[model samples]
Target: MSRVCELTGKGPITGNNVSHANNRTRRRFLPNLNDVTLMSETLGRTVKLRISAAALRTVDHRGGLDGFMAKARESELSARALKIKKEIEKSLTAA
Candidate 1:
């Protein structure tokens, strides 16, 4: 799988590493991603997602996966996460 955060869309960034001798080297800065399984209260299931550590903290701060998904913008989420968000919304409406 690609090194991308499903929720926050955080990914590797390209940059140059500068040295003391005024030398520059190409480098990539990757996001701190973790494979986590978060439980969805509305759907009554656990969803596995590769997301950034910051996003995980945001989910915790927002009260849960459902709350985070509800508040997150559609453009920021990955395709899979967008689908899960839709399912969560549907379950919420059904409940």
Candidate 2:
């Protein structure tokens, strides 16, 4: 899979690496991503996602996966995460 954060939609960024001799080279800054499996209480299942370390911390700070998704903006989420968010919302409404 691509080096992207599934929840935060963060991807590699291109930049120049400068040297002491005033030389520049192309370089990529990749996000700190981790493959994690978080449980969804409402859905009664565990969801696997590739997310940034910052996002994982945010999820924990927000109380859990569900809390984070509930407060997260749709535009900031990946397509897969958006789908999961929808399912989470549906489950919340159903319960």
Top TM-score prediction, candidate number: 1
Candidates in order have lDDT scores of 0.95, 0.92
> Predicted candidate 1: what Cα RMSD to the true structure?
0.8
lDDT of 1 by residue, 15-87 (tens): 9999999899999999999999999988998999999999999999999999999899999999999999999
Number of colliding residue pairs in model 1: 0
Off by over 4 Å in 2: none
Lowest summed lDDT window (length 10), candidate 1: 86-95
The estimated TM-scores of all candidates read 0.95, 0.92
- lDDT at 58, model 2: 92
- In angstroms, how far off is 31's CA in candidate 2? 0.6
CA RMSD per model (angstroms)? 0.8, 1.1
